[model samples]
Target: MSEPAAEAAAPAADNKKKKWLMIGLIGGGVLLIVLSVVLAVVLSHGKSKKGQSKAHDTEQQAEEGDAEGGGEEHADAEEHGKKEEGHEKPKAEHGSAEPEHTTETHKPAEGGKPGDEAALKAEADQLKQDIAKLQHEMDQQTEMLTLSDEAAKLKSEINALKEKKASLEGDKQKLAEGVKQIRSGEKKCAISGNPDKRLDELRACLGMSQHGESKPGEHKPAGDSHEVHWSYNGENGPEFWAKLKPEWKVCAEGRTQSPINLVGKFGSGVPALSYEYKSSALTVVNNGHTIQANVAEGGGVVLDGKRYKLLQFHFHTPSEEQINGRANDMVAHLVHKSEDGKLLVIGVLLNRGKDNPVLKPVFDNMPGKASEEKAVPNAGFDANRLLPASRNYFHYDGSLTTPPCSEGVKWFVLKNVGNISPKQYDAYTQLYPYNARPVQAVNGRAIVEN
Candidate 1:
């Protein structure tokens, strides 16, 4: 039993096993076919995945390469820009490849972008150059201003110095003039005392008394009247005055001329006549022609030890004293009275030059207008030089020489004459070139010459 059963069982089992194997095989085949299909799909999928991975890798690599290339391109562009900017030349960059865009934001290098940094540097350089130029201009302006101020200061200083020098020069000239005037005064004082010595001293001190030594040749009388008309430099001019004035007859008759040519005339052998003078009270009178200084009662004149009372002194132009018929420039008539009331006149001649010490006081005291009177204060006028040195004289009985000529005047004219300067002559001539009367016939008078 066992064998048959075992054999059947075994065969059934083998058949079952075979069937199971076939099922398994079929399943395995199906699984294999599915597996094969799945494998194929998987393989395909795997292959596709591998291909996608490879594609992804390739894409990543290409992205990396693009990134690297973009970086290099950017560097090249920057380099080209720098080169162009250095030369101040314009350049353009065009990217045909698509740009590698990045989300990350960045700033420019230090100051700005490449071009911007270049522009900023240029602007900084321009600012520096502008500042330097402006500073230089400001320095030039400051220097110019300083120079102008210095020039103005120097000019002002120079002007001030010039003014000071001018003032000092003026003062110096004034002082010199004052000293010269003092010297002239001393000389005049030394000459005033003695008649004989004074005459020679005066001749030595003064120049020629007359423009011409003698009066010009007399011309026939045209007419005579109070309103007589005369030409300045024609016939009957100032030169021939002796022919025109009766009171001026002594002009031709006198031995010595007034305004005497005194220089070199004095000699060591000549002795001066002695005389003295003192201050006296003075009264003043105004006439139509000039003012007169009247000697007061206390005043006296002593001549040769003869005492006389001084009356008055009057002025005249073209003085009565004459040298070879030449009249003096000006004269003063000093009237004196003897103890017996006899009248005596002393004549003093005057000429012009630098101001005369003796004449300045008299002229200063003179009344300006005709008929205007003024009293002299501290009267101190010298009368020693008033008379002619030569006592020898022409004696005649005549009238007053002025207007309303009175008769019965005892005229004693000394032969010697006095001197004056040419300026004084011009001054007197300016006042009255011809103020005297025509010469008269001597009327049987005794004429004398020294």
Candidate 2:
């Protein structure tokens, strides 16, 4: 009995040990398969994360490079603007994040060993989550880089606009200064009251001065030297001369003015002039109105048994006096005054023909500006050279031809005509196109012609 029992017990125990061993081996193989699957999943997730990190780095680098290029382009533009404005360029302040991207780099994790299946599976899932987080961060960085680039572009545009505005302001300031200078010059002209003379003086101050001239009235007191502005045209012209000053009222209201037409019957017993003229230094002046010459104190003429001293002579284009309703090229008025302040004028008609030898010195040295006087020191001018060989003339009672237009003046117009070169006529006309006053009414005055 004991032998049988022992044999059976030993066989059963061996069978049980073999079954337990098989179960242990099978369990180990299943655990290995699960660990391998977890390892594969972890490796795939790591590779995916690494690839994403590399792509993000490449994108970030590209964006950084673009930002750098944009910055460089903006700097060039700023430099060009600075050169145009004649100043130094200012620094840019916006979109300065390129340095942060350059310093950062993504690195993958080291290799790992397989462990329990559940533990490995959990580790792979955690790795996947980490990779997703990193990818999200890279996407955010890329967006930030894009925004930075846009900001940089906007900043560059703003700087360019600022520079343009500054340039415009500078131009405006220059224009303002020029206007101020012009206004100041106009003020000085207003103070002088003699627009032509003041304008010449202003031109001199501005480096554009010209010179040639005459004195209209020299016998007046120094305090009465204020110029009565008048011209041949515009508001201050001859038509308005009567309203310019109280002394010039006769220009518009008085009758018996000089420069009357010598039409109708000629009266008899015309006076012959007796001239006693001396050689003296010649002085020429260009008044605003015409060219004039001043004579020395000794020259005098006797007409109708009365003595009148020759004071000055002036010229007018298209002669002021009309002989029988016809006009000449020019006329010379030799103004004379008697001891009692009576005025007398000798009118000489001029025609364009041969040059007059007597007028060479005065014409050659004509002044260029108003009120300018030039004295010919070494050259002596004879008053008798102005007269023709015959003393026959037409005599009449008239008024002064100038602004005062005072009546009771004696006029003597020579019968013989004077000749002047076409060049001399043109030279005088160039300075004064038309200075002759309009012919006054005869007013029943008698003209005596010899």
Candidate 3:
């Protein structure tokens, strides 16, 4: 019994020992696998922590960059606002609000989660692009404004140039018209061939006479009552006299007119003049042109054996005739007419000297109103006292000094000038300041000294 029992116990003990060993080995492998799994989980958690730390750093860097860029952009916008304040106030206001918008955008980035960093970065990039676009648009608008200002200045300059060119054209036209008038006068004088006869024909063509009536078959009807009105200044002055009537064209177009300069060599075969005067009734009249005194029609002068009766006499200030390129203070023209309707004028130049009793009656009783005639009763005036001591004279064939400036009149200007008181000269000048016409061109006309 002892042997059998010992063998069975030994086998069962061995089996139990083997089973426990296997269980122990299996438990050891399970423990190793659990430890490995715990280590892997710890490593993964550490790597995740490291990655989150890196992403946080990058987000912080991006936020700082965005803040710096926004600050710089806001500063630039503020500066631009100040620069554009004058011309564009609306743009200035828009630029001034940029700093506020940048501040609001940066507020969200300070408390943002690490997970939202990429979205914040993407938004910042888009905002930067928008800012860049706005800047580019503002720059373009500024350039456009500058160009517009320059264009306005150029337009103003162009307008000024146009105005100056127009003024120059007007002046050129006036000069051309004046030249044409001068050429026409010269042509007419050349075609006539006779200077003295041409003057008469011009006067006849102009329909001008001393009595203010048109000649027959020249212009308006002989019975026409239309009177040509003129004045010393204003629209009806000498500058516009030619345009007043068709017959008075020669006043502006005549080449050989009166009141010429007595310069150059004298001509030969000059006729002498002899004056025979007598006392006559003095009738003064203000004929709207000058103070004229009418004689009794008996006074006469002998010129080349032709007797011409003195009809009237008138005075002029700053004498119409220039003697030796100089003018006297005043002059007296004694008008005379021959039987054949020919005219002759004796000009007596007067200067400031002793008071002349010969002209006292004409000045003291002068008429006041235009076209008014007044006869001084018992006012005896002798024509001889009006002449100088010397009878030497310069003669020329010219036209009347007044419009219509009739021509073909024989003029005798005394070489020895007479004398008149300052009071007498002033009496005539008070009424008409400048009644004499501008001196006409000589046009190669002959002047004689006798």
Once superposed on the true structure, which residue ranges of model 3 sit more than 4 Å away at CA? 1-225
Candidate 1, residue 189: CA error in Å? 39
The segments of candidate 2 whose C-alpha lies over 4 angstroms from its true place after superposition are 1-225
Model 2, residue 108: what's the lDDT? 42
Best candidate, TM-score-wise?
3
Overall local distance difference test of candidate 2? 0.67
Q: Which model, 1 or 3, shows the larger TM-score?
A: 3
lDDT of each: 0.46, 0.67, 0.66
Off by over 4 Å in 1: 1-277, 301-307, 321-323, 339-341, 351-355, 385-396, 412-433
The TM-score measured for candidate 2 stands at: 0.50
Candidate 3 or 1, higher lDDT: 3
Model 3 over residues 118-155: C-alpha lDDT tens digits? Answer: 77899999999999999999999999999998997687
Residues 52-157, candidate 1: write the lDDT tens digits: 3221111111222234335533312211101111345222222213322212112333433456566788999999999999999999999999999899768756
Give the Å error, residue 88, model 2: 97
Residue 315 CA displacement from its true place in model 2, Å: 0.4
